[model samples]
Target: MLSDYFPSVGGQRAPDAELGATLRDFVAQQQGPISAHLRHRHTQTNEIGRCVALWPVLAHIAQESGGAALALLDVGSSAGLNLGVDAYTLCYHCGGASVHVGGAPRTDCRCCVASCVGSAARSMGCANLPVAGALSHRLGLDPMPVDVRDTDATRWLQACVWPCDLVRQQRLALALELARQHGWQVKQTGPSCIEAIHAWLDGLPSAVQPVVLNSWVLCYFSEQERARHEQAMIDLVRQRGVVWVSAETPSLRPTDMALPATPPHDSKGATLWCQVSHHAGEVRQRALAWSHPHGAWLQWLG
Candidate 1:
């Protein structure tokens, strides 16, 4: 709407909520003749601050769509490394199928969650005993896709991981490889994703349930632009019987205002996961949680 999602912040050095100038000073302090060639590395790693925050969103999609062939649109996906996360990893059983990757970092799963999984597997309704396979299937959409294979991009990708971000980076790398293996085309520069996604849906055949769609991209949009994009998505969901889920953290908590309510772009946005009919209708679910690819936890809204 305003040239780019950033509007016009001018050229002033923006203030970060955290990290401050530590990153700048850290690189400046380390120097050798070779260090002169690596000046830009600092800014690259500066981005890893809250990198892994996207996992819950991906996990939510897996549960809602279960097996739906989704056409994902990341509102402001940078380098699009997130899309690759789904492809390169696995879920381990015994302990309720925790995730594992050859070279990625790990997220400590709740032991209680694992116990529930084991119990469900042993339930009488589960006629197919001795489940031995891992959960699979993942998709993503990004307006800006970083070249996962580019040397600089890869290094930047590696640098962007946070101090304890072994799990995120490794998972992303695995996902990227899987995307290539499966031919998941990531569109780096496309028209407004709001419109593009609708058009793409037009070409899909009917009976595509859970037609799951989401936006993990707000950083790139101007206030009004984010609304337009979100509204466009909602309108489509209303027109076609499908769910529109969203998740955003409240920019500022509300007093006298309801908590864990339907998404409104005004506040920062919650880590929301919702659904709509895939065909003609106007039905939506505001309370839901992560339950996907594998039988993950399905906690309710707050």
Candidate 2:
């Protein structure tokens, strides 16, 4: 991790040091083992921050569907952190700006830490609805799912965090705790995972609505694979009406993918949000809002 070599701007071993040079020197030392490290380390950052923007859309869907229990299938869910989305509380500040804070940043620190915040709330229709008992079945699908109980795996997940961000780190700790308490399972996903999902959905009672979610996962797939997966979901919707939510980077999601015009951006960078429903061979897409990939904050356009 480049962050390990990064010295904080101030109050560090190398005060007034050039950041670029320090990073270069560290990279030089890590030259030969970079590939080996990459093979072992999955950049599977389960950005719990993303839930700030995701939860509202989820709640809205559940509420609109007559408050029916939901079966949430999270693809590329490393360690299943977001599977516990209903466990946490959200605090909205100044309309679009929402934050989720829990526990102390450090054992010695007394102040509460706000981990994730959306950039802006362009629309006010988003309500902080109750999440309790909203989810009946939670399935985490990943090619490689980390075992939260394994100390090594858990440590690696924490190491993936930006070295300087203690607030985010603390939030990760809390999310892990919640995941364990909730007993969320991380399962292997393959080409057959979709078929397995269909089987699972078929067995569920008519009352339970199915919701499929994935954040920054399709980028791992080739363009052809992504297209196939997208088509499969579209087909599935026609068979049984389902909800799909995705958060992707600009390269993967074109501005015109859902909406015709370009969306607005915040300080973090460009992220594209899409919510869709396909039924009776007709596909309807809602351009929810542009959000930070890590859910730092979001501008709610839905």
Which candidate comes out best when scored by lDDT? 2
Worst lDDT window (10 residues) for model 1? 111-120
Error of 1 at 65 (Å): 8.8
On residues 1-302, what C-alpha lDDT tens digit does candidate 2 reach at each position? Answer: 34544332223343235667867777789877776778778776888777766776676677657788888888888998888776655544433423221211111211111233232222232233334337888888887888888887887788788767667777787788667766798787675357767876887788888888878888888888787777777666667777887777755553236442443334345456677776457777766655566665555555
Best by TM-score: 2
The lDDT of each candidate is 0.39, 0.66
Model 1: per-residue lDDT, tens digit, 1-302? 11121212222233454344555555566557337557534333212112122233334444445544444444444554334433222222334443321112232322111111111122221121122222232234554455556666665655555434344455445544543455544555464675556655676656453233443445456777666766666667677644455533333111112345432222232333333334333344443332221223222231
Model 1, position 250: C-alpha lDDT score:
33
**Model 1 regions more than 4 Å off:** 1-140, 210-212, 250-258, 261-270, 276-281, 290-302
Overall local distance difference test of candidate 1: 0.39
Assess candidate 1 and give its TM-score to the true structure: 0.53
